[model samples]
Target chain A: MSVKQQELEKSWQQYKTQQRKKNLYYAFLTVLSVVVFLAIWEAVVRFQLVNVRHLPAPTVIFQTFIEKLHSTVPDGNTLGQNVIASLQVSLTGFFFAVLIGVPLGLLMGWFEPFDSFVRPLFELLRPVPPIAWIPVVVVFLGIGLKAKATIIFLTVFVSCVINSYAGIKLTSRTHINLMKTFGAGTWETFFKVGVPSAMPMVFTGLRVSIGSAWSTLVAAEMLAAKAGLGYMLQVGRGVGDARIVVLAMVTIAALGATLSALLNTLEAHTLKWKEMR
Target chain B: MENIAEKNIDTRPIKVEVKNLTKSFGDLLVLDNLNFNIRQNEFVCVVGPTGCGKTTFLNCLTRILEPTSGDLLINGESADPKKHNLSFVFQEPSIFPWATVEKNIACGLEVKRVPKDEIERRVDRILDLMGLRDVRKAYPKDLSVSTAQRVIIGRSFAMQPDLLLMDEPYGQMDIKMRYYLEDEVIRLWKELGSTVVFITHNIEEAVYLAERVLILSNKPAGIKEEVIIDLPHPRDITDPKFIEYRNYITDQIKWW
Candidate 1:
């Protein structure tokens, strides 16, 4: 082979080997840390270092989680059913928030009159946390799916609007001028240049909104809901079952992480252009 | 130069007419009562010292910034972007970062809602012309500086615009890249047969590309001299006559 070709091959091989080593090291550390954490937790509770009443052993929580997966536990529904129920409510609220918030924010940022009318109200309600609306939502909408969804919707909507609006406002002037010079009308410019430019920020809003939606699930289900992971947590706490509480917390965290990962994948696919940067 | 002007007089129709064009930002006057007429299909380069409102002149011509007291007529009518087919290649790389090279070139035709087949034909032609056929699928961020600028130029030319305004599109490129792209631009100009108003501060570049060089004075800019570049295509910078034209224009723009 030529010297340059040989050098290129050597560099490629080095890069592959370095990548493989990094991946293996990361995997080893992750597994080791998880094993160590579980062993410490199990030992602490099994040996009575901490009261079992307060913190159950990892084994006990795992067993409870497995049992709950098949059999109806505190909420008369299996763990899978509870998870689906929570997902249904959160997804509905999240989707609705994205649908309304994105356009509203884009209009508010793009159109002066629309901003004047909606900005004041948005600012006023923005400082008030989504959780604070729980009492008011429950009082008016009653203890049902609508009430729960509304609470989650409010939580996700604010983030979506803020991000979308900022994205639209921050669009580069050069792009706008270029579009205008090409005989693009206002609406055409908005769709072609404005909307596409705002995509990165819109996806950021979607990611943040999904996170908020998951977090607000517990408070949304604080009402007298029959089937959901949040409801299971409430009942577990009411009856003082530490195993059930731990199981629900772990499931919530796992589910939230999985949903966020899914959203992240979608974001990467949609905004593949950003990867070039 | 006199012979070329006489030759242009026989067949060239006035493409753009600027009468008493003046622009000011409140107390800061930028362009002061400038008047010039550009012939159809003429490659005119506007050159001046730094911050001499060369960009302002282009912007006012496109009506992006309205002239304070003057009229700009394209084909005997007021210039309106909405009514006219016009395109601008900005000094900075203005290729849409979100779009691939092919899509960036197709943007103007897409906005105009041209037929799909024609848009495809134009985009393909431009990609080949700009020598971007290999990297047509690559986004702006992945390309080299000259490639990105080529995409911008190709986009403007793909529209087959009646008039194309370029604001120092090669300002940031190195000497070698600039020469290559300048040659590419001349090729495109010849093939497309569009009127071009190229703005730059470089006198050598102006002499190298333009049939007519419109030299402007320092700030609150007005026409200082109009130099007719009679050099043939593929001009040699080392040619004595080429250096003469370059030096003559350089003398016109020297503020010091």
Candidate 2:
């Protein structure tokens, strides 16, 4: 090969090696954080910072978690069944939240009159927490999937709407002006500029709302849940099985993290141009 | 297109007639009775001290800001694009961050309900002309200031508007890039021959680009003088006549 070609190949190899080293460095930092977190958790439980009766050790929790996963009750429902039930309620609520929130957000962002009109109403309802709506939701929908989902929906809706609105509004003034210069009518500009610009915010809201939905699942299930991780925790509390309660709590956290991570990946792929995490 | 030719072509020579165009922000007046006539196809550059209502004038032309009180005319009547197309190239590279360079350029076309294929074709041509063909699919974040500004100008030029208003579109660019772009804009003006009203604080830019440089006085701004450029196309900036005019405008502006 020519000297220039050989030099180019060598440089490219060096660049790739540097990139690999950077990736490895970041991976080590991430793993180190997890290890530190686990150590603190183990130390806290071992030192009896919280009563072992109420909060089991990490090892005990993991063992109990395995037992819960494998052990079947008389009804043949395993820990996974409970987790799936909780996930269903949260996912259902999240879907409804997005369905309702995105359009409302788009409306609020696109038209000034609507924004001024609807903004007050949303702000008024927003500060009222999702758990606060349990009674109202229970009264309206009764003790069923709908009621639980409604509680989760309320949890997710507020943030989703606010984020989506901010996303749309945050679109650069220059972009809006560019549309105006091109002879775009208001509606055309909304779809052409406002919607796409707000998409990143929409996803952000979705991620936040999904976590809220998952967190609210326990509270929602308290109303009329026959089977869910929240119900499992409630049952475990009744029998005073701290391990079961801890396991249930861990499962909730895991599910929330897992789903959020998945949604984050999806968001990254969808809004690849946005360069946002 | 020659300035005289442009003037004659605009049988209705007064495309924009600003009469007592006064603007104020509560107490301070930014523009005061700014009277001027811009003929169709005439490249008129307005140069003034910083914050001397150059942008305000363009905004007023675009209706982004409501003039406090003025009779602003376009094609002898109200400033409405239905009567005539109005386009603006802002100082900032206003390419939409979420959009590809092609999509940003097609924004105006999309609004006009032009056919998809036609939009694509025009966008391709404009991108190629602006030397943005390689980066057409790239987002604004990936592009340099010059490329981004070029995209902005390309977007405006694609509209094929009757009146093109530019607000220091090359202000963010380096001297070399600015000159190249200025030349490119001149080439575009000659090729498409659109009526342009350009705003700048730079005297050299005003002298370099416009057939007539309209000078505005400091705040509560109004036209102080109008210097007509008699130089031919691709005029030498280093020429004695160009330097003399630049110096003359500089002196007038320094005291204003």
Candidate 3:
């Protein structure tokens, strides 16, 4: 090999080793911090610094968490069943919202007349929080899966529309003109140029919506759920079982993080053209 | 004097004709009654002071911005983007960031609904011509500024456009890269035999690449001068005749 090629190979090896070391360090820190936090919590409760009823010891919560995996909690359903119920409602609502919202937003952004008609209604509806819709949703659809999924759908749909609209609005004018020069018609330009350009923003919307969807699902479940993490929390609160409440909260957090991470992986795969963050 | 520049050129039929074209934005006039004819297969460069409506002129030609009063004809008919196979490279890098280099170059042909094999053939030829074959699978964000601009240019050429409009495509490049790309453009023009209307603010660039240079005055801009560059290809900057042509155009642009 030439001298320059050998030098490039050496640098590439050095870069790879450095990256690996950095990743290992980050992983170590993450685990150490979690361990320290759990230890501090366990120590404080064991020493009776705080009431164990209000704040259960980490070991107690972990024990309950394990026990609830198969055994019924106060709601008469296992932790696994609650989790599956929540996932089903949230994912179903989120899927439909994305399927409809992204295309509607793109069309509103691309055509002025469509924007004129929809933007006023959208603005009127945007500020009213999705949680505020719970009473109305209950009245219209009653206390069922439809009611809960509708709540999650409202939260996810707003974000999807806003981001997708902004994406299409901010599309570079030069790109549109370039499409025109290539003899592309309105629909062709929108589908080929506008849609693809809006993808990064659309994925960003999906991430934000999924996060909101999880939280909204919890709220909806707590209000009128028959089975889910939020229902478990509600039952725990009614019976004054702080361990179950804490367990439910932790489960909700972990599930939210996992789902968001999955969406992030999808975003990275689709938008590999973006500069790596 | 205008007739002098018109003499001794190949009698190729006129490809673009702009007659008394005037454009105004509200009360602000931009292009003031301009007329010009570009022959088929000619490489014409347009240069003017900054903000002299060079872009507006090209926009009018491409029907992106309609002229208030006048006509732009392509082969004796009004210019219609739908009917014409034209391409434009903007002042900024306009390659689709979502597409790979190869796909970006093929975008025009795809839009025109060319056959798959023909599209591949054209894309391969342009990739080879632009020296982008090695980086065909790379995205725009991964390439250097020069390579990105070359990809845009390659995209325009891949369409095999009847007339290609370029608006200072190398305006952001440093001098070395600009000159290199200018040579590449000239080589491509020779090879493809497509008419080009290259707009730039750089006089030396105009002299370097143009068969005839159209110099415009300040806004409301009009053609102030047209200089025919008779210099041979592979021109040298230090050549006395080349310097003379550059200085002659420079003197005409002294409207400050």
True contacts kept of each: 0.71, 0.59, 0.78
Indicate the worst ten consecutive residues by lDDT in candidate 3 chain A. A217-226
Evaluate chain B of model 3: give its TM-score: 0.96
Candidate 2 chain B worst ten-residue window by lDDT: B1-10
Residue A39 lDDT in candidate 3: 99
Expressed as tens digits, the lDDT of each residue in A47-151 for candidate 3 is: 999999999988999999999999895889999999999998899889999998998899999999999999999999999999999999899999888888998
* Candidate topping lDDT: 3
Q: Candidate 3: where are CA atoms >4 Å away?
A: A1-7, B1-7
> What value does DockQ give for candidate 1?
0.70
Candidate 2 segments whose C-alpha is farther than 4 A from its true place: A1-17, A35-63, A74-76, A275-277, B1-30, B33-35, B68-77
Q: Give DockQ for candidates 1 onward, in order.
A: 0.70, 0.51, 0.82
Docking class of 3: high
Q: Highest TM-score: which candidate?
A: 3
Q: What TM-score does each prediction get for chain A alone?
A: 0.89, 0.89, 0.94
In model 1, the Cα lDDT at residue A247 comes to 88
> In model 2, which residue pairs have backbone atoms overlapping below 3 Å?
none
Worst 10 residues of 1 chain B by lDDT: B1-10
Candidate 2, residue B67: the lDDT equals 87
Between candidates 1 and 3, the lDDT winner = 3
Instruction: Find the 10 residues in a row with the least total lDDT in model 3 chain B.
Output: B1-10
